[model samples]
Target: MTGKGGTGKTTVAAALALGLAAGGHRTLLVEVEGRQGIAELFGLGPLPYEERRVAGTADGGEVRALAVDPELALLEYLDMFYKLGAAGRALRKFGAIDFATTIAPGLRDVLLTGKVKEATTRTADRRRVYHAVVLDAPPTGRIGRFLNVTAETARLAKVGPIKTQSENVAALLRSPMTSVHVVTLLEEMPVQETVDAIGELNGLGIPIGKVVVNAGRPPLLTGTKVSQAELRRGLAAAGLPTDRATVSGLYAEAKAHLTRRELEESLRVELAELGQPMVELPLLPSGVDRAALDTLAAELLGTR
Candidate 1:
C-alpha cells in the first residue's frame, strides 16, 4: 500500500495484512522505509531484520512483519549470491555498505525490494510461505521510481546479479498477482497525486489495485440546508436551550458540515472516474489502536 505521507498507508497496509490473514492464511507485511512504522503501529518494540510474527487471527491465521533494512539486505544479497559471509560483515565495519548504498541509491532500493520479492516467492517444502504479502512501500511521490527496479538498476549494473535481481523484482511487481493500491483522502492534492501515481503505474505496466479512500466520514446532514426553526423546535422538545445563539451555532455547524460533505462528495466523484475498485475506511475518532485496527480489518474483509 502507498499514498501521500499522512494518508495512513502503513495503517492500511497493516489492516490489510490482518484482513488477509483471516481464515487460516498466513500473510507477510513488509516495510522498506526503515522508520519502524510497522512496529509502532502494532504497538511492539523495535523489529529485528528477520521476519517475526506480530499478530494472529482467531481462525488460525497469522500475520508476520518484516522491516527490511537496506544495509542488512545488501549484506544478505552479498551472502546469497557471492557467498561473502564474514567478508560482508567486514565491509560493514569499514562503512563500505553504507557508502555503496549512498553512492548508488538505486542499489539500495534493489536490496530493499529484492527482500520483498524473496518473501513473496519464498517456499517451504515446495509450498508458498505466505498466503499474501502486503508491502508498505514508499509514498506516491517516489513510488514510481521505487518500484521500477529494473530501470533503476540498469544504470548501475548492465548484466550482473544486481541486474538479474532487479529484473526479477520488476517482473513480480508488474505481474497479475501484484496490484499497487494507492490510498488517498477526500482532498484535492492527495486525490490529484493518486491520479498521477496511478497513471505512472499504468505507464510502467504495473497493475492498479483498489483506490483506498482513508479516513472517510459519512455525510451527516440529509440536505444541503438545515431549517433553523425545526432545529430550535427540536432543541426545545429535547429540553435544551432554544435561544438565538444556540440555534445559530447549530445552524453554522450544520452548514460547515454540509460544505465539507460536498467537497468530499466531489472528490469521491473525481476518484470514481478512475474506474478502480474503491474502498473507504472510516475515520477513527479514538485514533488507531489495536481494536481500531481490528475494526478496519473487518471492514476490509467486509465482515463488519
Candidate 2:
C-alpha cells in the first residue's frame, strides 16, 4: 500500500495480513523498510531480513513474516551475476555492494523489488505454498519512483538479465490478479498522495484496488461546520455549554477542537477526483486495543 510515513499504512497492512492469515490463507507479510512493525504488533521481535514463521495468533493456517533487506537482495544479485570466487572479496575490498546499492536511491528500490519477486516465485515440493504476499511497502512519496526503476533498469540494460527481470516484474505489476492499495487518511497530504499514487500506479499498468482510508472520524458532529469560527458560532447559537461541566462535556470540547471539517470536505473532493471507493477505518481510541484492530480489519474488508 502507498501512503505517507506514520499515516497508519504499516499498521493497516499488519492487520490485513493477520486477518487474511486467520481466514486460512497461507499468507506472508513482507516489510521492506527495517521497521519491525509486523513483529512488534504481533509481539514478535527483531525478525530477520528473511522469511520467518509468525507467532501470537489463534489461526491454524500458515502465516509467515519477512523483512527484506536490500543488502541481502544485492548480494543475491551479485551471486547471479558473478561466478568467480574472488568476486565477493573484490566487492568487499571496494567497500561492498551494500553501500553502492542500499545507500543509493533507485538501486535500493530495485533490490527491494527483487526480494518481493523472489517470494512470489518460491514453491515447495511441487506445490504452491504462499497464497498472498502483503507488502508493507515504502511510503506513497517514493512508490511511483520505486516501480519505475524496473522500466529504467530495463532501458539501461536493454538485452540481458536486467531486461528479463524487468519483463517479469512488469508482468506481475500489470497482472489483474495482483492489486496495489494505497493506505491513507481522510486528511490533506496523505489523501493527495493516495490520489497521485493511484494514477501513477495505474499509468504503469498496476492494478489499483481499494483506497484504504485509515483512522477516519465517523461523522459525529454532523453537517458543514466549515471552520472553527463557524463551529463556535453554531455551538454558541445552539446554547450548549461553553465551559466544562460533566466529563462528557470536556470530551465534546476536545472532539470539536480536533475535528477538521474543511479537511474532510477536501478529502471527499480529492477522493472523487481519483474515483476509487475508500475502505475507511474508524478513528480508534487512544492506545488502540485488539478489538479496535479487529474492527479495523472487518471494516477494511467491508464485513462490518
How far out, in Å, is residue 50 in model 1? Answer: 0.8
Candidate 1, 177-260: lDDT as tens digits: 898999999999999999999999999999999999999988777674668999998999999999999999999998888888
TM-score to native of every candidate shown? 0.97, 0.81
- Using TM-score as the measure, the top candidate is 1
List candidate 1 stretches off by more than 4 Å.
Answer: none
Candidate 1 structure, TM-score to reference: 0.97
Which ranges in model 2 have alpha carbons more than 4 Å from their true place? 80-94, 102-104, 222-259, 288-290
Top-lDDT candidate index: 1
lDDT of 2 by residue, 164-258 (tens): 77667767767775778888877787877887788788888778878887777766555533554554555677886544343346556656654
The residue pairs in collision within model 2 are none
lDDT of each: 0.91, 0.73
